[model samples]
Target: MALAQYARLGVISRSAPGLVLARPLLAAVPRSTTTSVLRSLASSARAGRFASSRREPGMVPVGRRTRELPVNTIIKFVPQQEAWVVERMGKFDRILEPGLAFLVPVLDQVKYVQSLKEVAIEIPTQSAITQDNVTLELDGVLYYRVVDPYKASYGVENAEFSVAQLAQTTMRAEIGQMTLDRTLAERNQLNINIVESINTAAHDWGIRCLRYEIRDIHPPENVVQAMHSQVSAERSKRAQILESEGARQAAINVAEGHKQATILASEAVKTERINEALGAAEAILAHARATAQGIEKVAASISDSPNGHDAVSLTVAEKYVDAFGNLAKQGTTVIVPTDVNNVGSMVAQALAVYKNIGQARETPTALPKDSRKQAILDTLVPQQDTPPARK
Candidate 1:
């Protein structure tokens, strides 16, 4: 019933045989008035098996007939070429050249002609095996251009889909031949190899695979985690080594500083000792020089005196008394000359000794005051007496 309505409305072309019902009454129709009559016949044919294929612009379909029909005659049937152009009018009509065209009407229709420019294909997610037999998920994008319109439209059912399959196959093959390390290190080479291989296989389909890119690589979760841990461990090891080296250097510096300080301290001690020894030697020399000067002064005074005999007696007696006093103070026992045994004798002996010493200097002794020695010495000194007897 729908087909009958489409036929009445002239929606489908009736050019192909067995597509619509044939009417003998419309055979004798003239071309100028035949459309209205065909429309009436289509209204009657709607309830029958005469279905309309499609309606075309500037062209009409003729009903299926047992007899051969001439071209260019008006009928309910559409020509194969006109129907072909009409079916695809919505897709390529703007680019298609306007002229006579043909199709099989319901049996054949025109498909859209895609542009020949570069088209991007979003690669589907895929898995590939590495040389180590590790599976990886990868994704990418593809760039392609159509080289031939006819071949691209007819040669393959889907040129983009065919290129994608080729890309996936080539990528898998390349990846399987290489280890994971090589695959990651030589990604540019991998991309070029896949592109070339895909381009070679896609020539028949009128597609030129210009470039293939492997964008992101997804390794196994365990492998990624292992790599992360390895990196962390390496960093930690380096840090510890550096810290140890720094500590070792610090210790070395401290030891060296202590050694230097000890050497300096020892040098200071040696310098102080030398200075002290020099000072002590100087002090001893100064004391010896002062003592010698004192001795020279005393000797000169004694020599210049006129009564040198008396001066010698007094100085000798004072020295003797001082020695005795020192000895008595330092010792438990003291010895002195016995006055009862030798006082007169010792005094006379001292006077005689003094006389002799004075004669050597041609001087005389001064008698002690309030002593008998003054009168005695005055009486005995200048008398020219008889010759001294030898005794």
Candidate 2:
């Protein structure tokens, strides 16, 4: 198996005498992989050079080395999500992708392997003065990714520490620009502004600012009290406004109801008045019709009666007796007939006038009864003055 393996990997000699090399190894691997391999081997060869680099990563063993160094170097294996920065004589050379790479020994160096994954870093709590001159203690977290390995390794001493400090200073500056209320109220805007500010400066450092989040913001006791009071007052004002609106709506409803009731009541009154007027008008029309009918009946009877004269004379005498009787009963001073004998003459004149009216219409009726005439005569007769027999 050893012979077959040796045959498969044919070995050759370099330009130097007695120096055997496996140039086939570098030929079989890619330039990047071969370069990385050579750089790591060179880093390990420089006795004290790689000693301090022990803290750095990417020291994995790939192949066995002979007692004599080879002209071509073995390739290094790079894992996923990792990068290796190569420096030629301590100067920036190239970034090694995840693969097998070889380099010139003693000339190239594998500085370190950098992680391209995102990391979350916590920013310590810091005291800052707002634009309103209010002092507040605040803390947050930051997420970042390393985009460029070369700049990350050589641009800054400590990327994590430098990023943290930059975030702190930028946060303070941003907080200083705004008032305390804006900072506390607009957290999203604050985070966006902080991310923007940090990203602007972090591009040179090969660090990408992903996102930032505010964790805690502690205000002074006095400020907290004032905020609480302001909130309470706002709540109270809203409640009062809502209550007033409710009351106003109720009042409008009540007033509308009253107006409707008044309209209905007035309508009823108007209807009643119209009904009463209609009833009165009907009564007056009936009364006028009744009066006309009564007058017509009396006139017809007078024209049909042949003895209408005697009946009229009897009616006049009876009416005169009734009047004299009522006057004698009610008044202390009585109105005597001008002459007691004149009553008979007045009734006789009434009889003659009615007789002439009946003859003209050609109607004859029976005379009144003899008793009624005798009673009328007796009522009209006055007793002669009686002499007083004794004082």
Candidate 3:
């Protein structure tokens, strides 16, 4: 009776070959058309043979053509950092976010799955020629994330594989702009450049190219040997330059030291000569002053004497006799006057001459006024008459 009513309402049709039942018809098809209706119809057609497929034992079949199930069945549960793409009637409809999700079985099937977590893709190693025409083998790894699930599922066939290929192409292009030395020395810059390039081109692919790292770069063995030789030569060049600089500095320092020592020695000599001359001058001046003091005292004493002229005459005669005796004692040769008494007369004449000399240009020192000094001079003058005591 239900099948007749459904048939009368134009909900079902029959196929020609085996009277197969067709799907129920609706006045207006829904945007989210459920595809489970077809599965149910098919399941009912094969009911007896596969009734136990998804059925629990000990449960009897509720109807002859189909088994009844709850109409508003709630399907729940989603995973963390996972996105599920839903399709209605075999057409992509919507994407399911993380956490619990509802689906009308078969109709809202998960068509595409995308992980929201970061993915690391290894770019295959390949040879690239640098700007300086140096060929090198390079490999790298790329990190990316699926920012948009809808585009990730529909924009590209394989996200990891496509990103890897894009990263490789970008890396090669970036490497081609730099020399081999720059590539090796500035690896971090190279990585950033490649990542930027990949991200710029892969923006539409729902991928956020986080970072790209060049794992390794290998040059030829012959190039390695050449680099080693170049390094050694550079080191030797720097060492020679340093050594020459040190030698030059040492020579300059030695010359400066010699100049300083010579200047000091000359200064020392000049100081010594000047000090000696000062000493000699000081001695001469001191002697002159002492002599002048003595002359002043002697003149004053002479002026005070009553017999100053006679005293001076006697002193000169006595000095003459003493000198004659000293010459006879100093050497083996001796001279004797023809008349020894004549020596007294000669001394008297010499004294007269000395007294005239004293009056002419200079005054002689006066004898002391003491009686003891006068007595000695008187005795000395008398004793000089006997000039005779042999040596």
Query: What's the lDDT for all of these models?
Result: 0.61, 0.69, 0.65
Tens digits of per-residue lDDT for model 2, 1-391: 2222422455222222122233434456576754655454444344322222121122321112112222224355666877777776668788778877787654565665677788788999999999999999999999998998878888887788899999999999999999988998898999999999999998998999899998999999999999999999999999999999999999999999999999999999999999999999999999999999998987788789998766766778887667557646854223244665666775654454344434533532333345434433444455579898996
* Candidate 1 residue spans exceeding 4 A from truth: 1-112, 182-189, 213-216, 248-391
List model 3 lDDT by residue over 225-277, tens digit each: 98899999999999999999999999999999999999999999999999999
User: Ten-residue segment with the worst summed lDDT in candidate 3?
Assistant: 57-66
Task: Using TM-score, give the best candidate's number.
Answer: 2
Off by over 4 Å in 3: 1-76, 256-260, 290-391
Q: Estimate each model's TM-score.
A: 0.40, 0.60, 0.57
Judged by lDDT relative to the true structure, which candidate is superior, 1 or 3? Answer: 3
Whole-model lDDT, model 3: 0.65
Against the true structure, what is every candidate's RMSD?
Answer: 17.7, 14.9, 16.2
Give the poorly placed runs of model 2, Cα more than 4 Å off: 1-73, 298-391
Better of 1 and 2 by lDDT: 2
Q: Order candidates by TM-score, high to low.
A: 2, 3, 1
Better of 2 and 3 by lDDT: 2
Can you give the lDDT of residue 355 in candidate 2? 48
